[model samples]
Target: MNNILRAKNLGKVYRVGKIDIHAVRGVNLDVEKGEFVSIVGPSGCGKSTLLHLMGGMAKPTTGKVFIEGTDLSMISDGERAKIRRDKIGFVFQRFNLFSALNSQQNLEIAMQICHNGNIDHQRIKEIMKLVGLENKLQHKPLELSMGEQQRVAIARALVNNPLLILADEPTGNLDSANSYKVLYLLKDLNRNLGQTIVLITHNQEASKIADRKIEMKDGMIISLS
Candidate 1:
């Protein structure tokens, strides 16, 4: 498989007064097309920071990130924003759904924003069904359970046919049963849709479903297998 993303000596540092906090340090990794890779670590390990850098949401303090062979650090902010909008999809722990809109409408808005008004109703329906939200299309986020809202978020992420899906603590807010449901859905997307997924989670069971796992500690990748 071809590499969809490549990171070379990637690092991030935050300054607080005179002290520098290293968030990520000298990480080199590659994610191939259509692979499910998970980064597992404790809090403050910079898992989310790595995902943000890969998605072009945050610039690395040192080193390079290449998405589809284009150097992300070399691109202008506007170009990077466009790259994120066109090539990457993000799912977060909060579910980030518009509470006022029904599930279908919420997905529609995502489609419009990603596709710029060329919404494909058929594709939207297919993705909704893939995430097991076909029957709950008209329900608002407030009316849905935590699991359902996350499913809607997953559907919205898939609506754009993104090259890579970045999920940050995707099941952190769910009960055990719902967590299993969401993980199963993510596995199915990898198996069936052939979507490239990069997930960051603290759950070991969740990390097991991934094809490859990287464990991080103190801003460094301690293990990769």
Candidate 2:
């Protein structure tokens, strides 16, 4: 299978006055095209950091990341930003939606931003329908339940038709029922749309939806299954 993402000797360090904290250490990961992988770990385990590195959101202190064979560390910030904008989508633990905007408007705004004003109403409708939010197009984030809000966020993430989706604890804010729904939606996306996904979560059940599960501890990967 073709590698959609790869990390070689990836590491990140943060210096606080007198000490250097290793947020990630010699970590390596690869995600195949159209494959769904989950990274599971406790808080402070560096799983989120690894996600950021892979998505070109942060520079690695030492090591390299290749996304679709482009070396992230070797690119200029503007170039990397272009790659991220065109190829990667992100879902965070919090639904970072504009509280005032309706669901459809939220997605439309994302589409404009992602495509530099080339709004695709047809594609937006398709994505909203895919995420089961076609009926709630006029509902604002505050008007919707947490699950609905997350689904809107997911729809916005898909607005640009990105090649990879990096989700960091996307179900963390929801209840068990809602979390199950969200996880199932992610799995369905992979199964139906061939969407490549890398989800970071502490929930074992949530992680199980992925094709492979990687466990991390204290800044290093401890297991892959």
Candidate 3:
């Protein structure tokens, strides 16, 4: 198994006025290819901060984040952005879809913005099919249910064929039924597509869906199972 991501003694600090607030304190993590790992924590537990650091959205105040052997802190912002664009896919709690564009078009826009290049029709089709949204490709966001919209979001994350997926509270906006559906979809994606996923959630049941779950508290990891 290839170690796709490694965070060494990860730490982050935000300076406000004269105080230094530590958000993540010596939090280390490693994620291998084709693995589904969930980080579970309460709000303000620093899980989201860790996700941003891991995905290269923010630089850490201490330690280092390594993605596919590239040290996130040592690289230039443009280089990190390229690594993020080429290797990491992100899914947020809100289904960040374009309301005006249909599902396929939404995916097309993501591919275009990431590389400013042509779309891969076959890959798009395969991703849509994998997320079970093949029939909904022509439908706008408003036309689909919350669950379907989330499915589209997942497809959009996979459109680039990224090496890793970083999903933050992906089912936060869904009802229990929809949440279950979304979790099931994620499990299926991990198992069938062989996609590596690192899901961050406050929901315990949601975290259990992953192959391993790490619990965080007060800017540090407390348990892993």
Cα-lDDT of candidate 2: 0.92
- Those runs of model 2 whose alpha carbons end farther than 4 Å from true positions after fitting are none
Clashes within 3 Å, all models in order: 0, 0, 0
**After superposition, candidate 1 runs with Cα above 4 Å error:** none
Instruction: Please give the RMSD of candidate 1 to the true structure.
Output: 1.1
In terms of lDDT, the poorest run of 10 residues in model 1 is 110-119
List CA RMSD, all candidates.
Answer: 1.1, 1.1, 1.4
lDDT of each: 0.92, 0.92, 0.92
Candidate 2 to truth, TM: 0.97
Q: Lowest summed-lDDT stretch of 10 residues in model 3? A: 113-122
Pairs in clash, predicted candidate 3: none
lDDT of 2 by residue, 85-164 (tens): 78898898998999989998998887777788888888888998999988898899999999999999998888899999
- Per-residue lDDT of candidate 1, residues 1-225 (tens digit): 389999999999999999999999999999999999999999989999998988999999999999999999998999998888788888999999999999999889888877778778888888888888888999999999999999999998888889999999999999999999998899989998799999999888899999999999988999999
